[model samples]
Target: MKKIETIHAVGHVLCHDVTQIIKDKTKGPVFRKGHIVTEEDIPVLLSVGKDHLYVWEKNENMLHENEAAEILFDLCRSEGMKGSEIKEGKIEVIADRDGLLKIDRKKLFAVNSLSEMMIASRHGDFPVKKGDKIAGTRIIPLVIEKEKMERAKEAAEGGPIFRILPFHKKKTAIVTTGNEVFYGRIKDTFGPVVKEKIAEYPTEFLGQTLVDDQKEHIQEAILHYIDEGAELVLCTGGMSVDPDDCTPGAIAGTGAQVITYGAPVLPGAMLLLAYYEKDGKKIPIVGLPGCVMYAKRTVFDLVLPRLMADDPVTFEELAALGEGGLCLNCGVCTFPNCGFGKGVVY
Candidate 1:
């Protein structure tokens, strides 16, 4: 590495090893604020003369490099904070409750590690809207390199805002279809059981229709809800290979693409998925096997959140869901936020 030097001046200067300030010699040096001259660099610094030996450092500023970057990530990527590029060295962040904060370029270069300098928003939940103040970041000590500050400022620019409208509450439609249930011989115990499990949500009554060993009618009813804006359509019973068990057949008739007819999961192995586009919006239809009625957890436990989310369900997404899709069927069921389908960043 090319060694540079500066001479002693009227004021003290801060000097740290070149390797400490710069990760790679290729990247060059970044001096933080409030630094003072040291004897280690005295030989080099002396060559530059007294006045030129002055080191860049200060106390009060909007943000230091590392601190500013951390704050920007928390706001832009994690907390959905809004910011605008004012200039090469300037970024302006405005919060509804916290007011406005200005980020200076010089301050960013004054800090070490970006993680130390960044500030995240207070909000932790997803679906953050615009203008939310996730966190506040600022650099201490003023003087810093122009390029290094620019790099830090650029990272704080913009990021994804996982926002979705809560206009429609999640409502489930339960359809129980089987020749036995239609004949009214064993009593429809499955319908009530499925209802009890999802009772946490404000599930609306979408009518329980009894179909006699017919997949056509089952598929027709599923399509009816898709047209009527049903977020989830659950088909109970008739998921087996028996000719009379036509629930899978009914789901196939909907003209919607089915991601999986069955999964490797237990209890709900017979679960199926069919998706259709209704006016450009993707509609997800789930075929719940008879096991779901009795089993504590099933594939239903896994795909519910993704279905409720305002996003289209794809084969890749469904396949990825299989990892945590199996239910341990623990002594008790802690649903909605369970290990089966832990939350994923959208």
Candidate 2:
């Protein structure tokens, strides 16, 4: 690549299709991709493309390919960099090993923040191993030399401290309980509601079972799900303290520790949570209140996120959900994301 001594700032960068490439006596010439052009190449470029060749003078702190790619990705996002006109200020770069380095719009391109640059240090496809740093990020000032930038990018590339997280689809299970539903009294409306909500996530049903309010029957059903490969077990109904409401007892009978029998939330406060190890693997069992069947939201809203997270639900964690656990049932319920309940992050 040939280095140019200086460049002329054409009034401004060109936009849209070529308006006109009129011939000029200056004999400016045009250079194609990979062409090493110096100051002497300017007049030649003018001749080939005619008088004006939409050219942008290089900046003293020009960003590298990967760095420029992050800027472009950020520019295209909803929270994109402000003041960057999509047409005039966009720069494109190829993706790296860890995919494209996307920059957040709120993150200003400060010299300090750009210290660590993610680069394609090694060559290969994905499925990179653990402890293998496919990409790295650091913050350095803009005063670094060009040769220094390459060295920094290279050093930051190999054995990076951080590795990209592998995307894992959320898995869930549904367990419906109630003598009325199990015995076909009310036609089991709760099962479908739970299914509808569970379907919204990238999860599988795993399996579901309908059992009477009998603690033994419900316990067997809960155990069956655990044996079948269900990490998250959601049991609807039989959650109240009424004599017939034995879902909580059944869940507890499964030898799982109940997190909380009651919560500060309304409509679904009569919730129950239990966890136990069967064959060395932990299983989560939830006794959903009757309100979950008809109410808009409740404790299930709080428990759902924890199940989807990489960690298991604990009594202390479930206990903290009471703060935002209450359900208002406002005129318009934009649940999960609204301020109504604890707001489960799907």
Candidate 3:
């Protein structure tokens, strides 16, 4: 790149995007790279306080910022994701499908540690929608050493820095227990709520069995769903310590690996989570507390997306939810978008 007086820069290409900042009113690029400066543009350029300008010039050792940015973009593109067009030496990574985003954070830090380059992304393990901006990368200079970009590539050698895990279709079975609903004393609210939540994913409630608060009946109903090919078993109600509440134990009686019997998040603390693995098949069993039937959002809302994506939850992971677990229960609840059960940093 070469520096020249703005008056004498006519016909010369602007080497970089010149952003015009008008206090808080506006701040955006008015002159883009490769744009030929004209005599008419002199006043506009001077108005933006550009007395001197950087013009494009070829150099073997130094690489143009656009070329350098694409190299950084290539380092972040994985399957199920694509990149936006290079804009002012920056390219944004976007999700090609709606799914959970997984980031190679350790390698990401290693790459950023290399000078003159950066890769910024959203937090890992979060849900994302198609066309969502996942990350953005740029070369930190108008021009940079070719070797530095190559070094950044070496630092992120494990493939792309991130990938999207698309949600899988699962055949789910919901078993709502409690004598009040089983005997028609109260309407079955939990069953409809679970159905509505899982409907957001590529899943279907194959069936729902309404059983009384009897351990034997609840156990039998759950096993029947598994034998009928239910990949996800959902048990609602009867999760608390009440003598009549028996869903949590019924789920355990199936000989499943119970991950956690209680959660830290508000609105769903009594929730039970477990996994049944046999003959190479793993089915997740959840015993949702009664709070789920009332709260608009809870731990169930937070973990449901991950489970639908076929991402198994570890006991350690559930324990990490305490930090961002408390729900504000705002007047107008906006879950998933709100911080309710967002989980904390480890």
Best by lDDT: 3
**Candidates' TM-scores?**
0.57, 0.51, 0.87
Q: For residues 190-271, write the lDDT of model 2, one tens digit per residue.
A: 8888888666444767766778778898888877877777777888877767787878888888888877787666766677
Q: Which ten residues in a row have the lowest lDDT in candidate 1?
A: 97-106
**Residue 302 lDDT (model 1):** 56
lDDT of 1 by residue, 1-346 (tens): 1123354422444423222323454443333323455656555444333334334344453333443444444433322234544222234443433211223223333332443234333322222234654344444323334454455555534332222223235556777787787888779888887777556444565656666777788877787777666767778888888867888878878887888887755657777888776777666777887787777777665555445544455555555555666677777776534556432322
Report the alpha-carbon TM-score of model 1 versus the true structure.
0.57
For every candidate structure, what is the RMSD over all alpha carbons to the true structure, in angstroms? 11.4, 10.7, 3.0
Provide the global lDDT of candidate 1 against the true structure. Answer: 0.54
Ranking by TM-score: 3, 1, 2
Worst 10 residues of 2 by lDDT: 79-88
The C-alpha stretches of model 2 lying farther than 4 A from their native spots are: 1-173, 342-346
lDDT of 2: 0.52
